[model samples]
Target chain A: DAMVIQNPRYQVTQFGKPVTLSCSQTLNHNVMYWYQQKSSQAPKLLFHYYDKDFNNEADTPDNFQSRRPNTSFCFLDIRSPGLGDAAMYLCATSTRGQGGGETQYFGPGTRLLVL
Target chain B: DQQVKQNSPSLSVQEGRISILNCDYTNSMFDYFLWYKKYPAEGPTFLISISSIKDKNEDGRFTVFLNKSAKHLSLHIVPSQPGDSAVYFCAAMTGGSQGNLIFGKGTKLSVKP
Candidate 1:
């Protein structure tokens, strides 16, 4: 079945170290997104790729970056991991159109722990 | 300010009963609303959605009602099952190219058998 997949469901990294989380989709959607979710908080949008164009949220920190090498793969790279950055990272995909109300399909998410 | 709001942090219901989850929004520009179900250690899955043009949409045992004038929407689950226990998140989107979803703090529902 077509679905979103994330690698390394749980990740541990030292503070100030760089880490990367991966996401791939079989749904062939045109849009891919990355979100950061802290405990008891709403999933905050970090960035997204509309096809090949990257769109970053205004409040997203500089430590977080995303790359979409192709339609099926996207990666989130944390330049400097911080204790506060430890949270569940989610990846989602959607086919743009239909008044921009397309339902986004999400992956299981990667839980990052910064030590 | 939160564009979408799910005031209830948690709810408890019995199996075979109706589970009602309510959501409200402060953004008048929001034209589409959706409900997502999330289990622990997993990503949220799309359950149901309603457009601003319509007041309600239903699929199987799940129904979503939208009150555009009041900026309120609700999800109703009939004959709620234990498997239905999860976090329900209310999300809203405006008609645009970005298609960014504004999510509310999720409500955790516990359906006891």
Candidate 2:
């Protein structure tokens, strides 16, 4: 079953501690994305890798960073976790075919809690 | 600022009836749109989509209508089934290549059988 997979469905991190949330895809997609969703709000794009190129949203906090070491995997690193950073982190993948090919497929999402 | 807006926080529909969900966007640059369904503790699943080039798109019992002039779009489910009940999200795509999506706050729908 080719699908996006996220590890540690439920994650707990202490405040000011660095934590990493990871994502991988069996879909072998050309693009991978990271989105942050809070309670009852729209999921906001944190950043994405268009193949090997990483594009970050303007308002994304400096505490957050990502590394797509290769095509199959990507990691979201929170250098200094804050209480407000606790939320569901989602990973999505898509192909880069004709017409932008931005229609994304999502994973189960990682719910992070700050202690 | 949120480009796409779903004003209704939730909706209740009787089974075998019609369910209509609405979405509005402020960005005129958005030419592509999509609707996604989600259940609790799960990620959103793509449901239906409509492009600005077309007025509507339909698949099975799901129909999505686009009004480019009004910058509004709506999803219609006829003879709605309980299985169709879930959180519906509307997303707007701006630019073409390397374009990112702007999503609206979702509306949770419950279908009573």
Winning candidate number (TM-score): 1
Clash totals, every prediction: 0, 0
lDDT of each: 0.94, 0.92
Error of 2 at A50 (Å): 0.5
Task: Give the clashing pairs for model 1.
Answer: none
Candidate 2 Cα misplacement greater than 4 A, ranges: none
Q: Write the per-residue lDDT of candidate 1 for residues B3-86, one digit (tens) a residue.
A: 899999999999999999999999898888889999999999999998888998999999999998888999999989999999
Candidate 2, residue B56: the lDDT equals: 96
- Per-residue lDDT tens digits for candidate 1, residues A1-115, read 9999999899999999999999999999999999999999889899999999999999999999999999999999999999999999999999997565778999999999999
lDDT of 1 at A6: 100
Q: Is the docking of candidate 1 incorrect, acceptable, medium or high quality?
A: high
- Give the Å error, residue A5, model 2: 0.7
Local accuracy of candidate 2 as per-residue lDDT tens digits, B1-113: 77899999999999999999999999888888999999989988988888888999999999999999999999999989999889999998954747587899999999999
* Residue B100 CA displacement from its true place in model 1, Å: 0.7
The TM-score obtained for chain B by all candidates, in the order given, is 0.98, 0.96
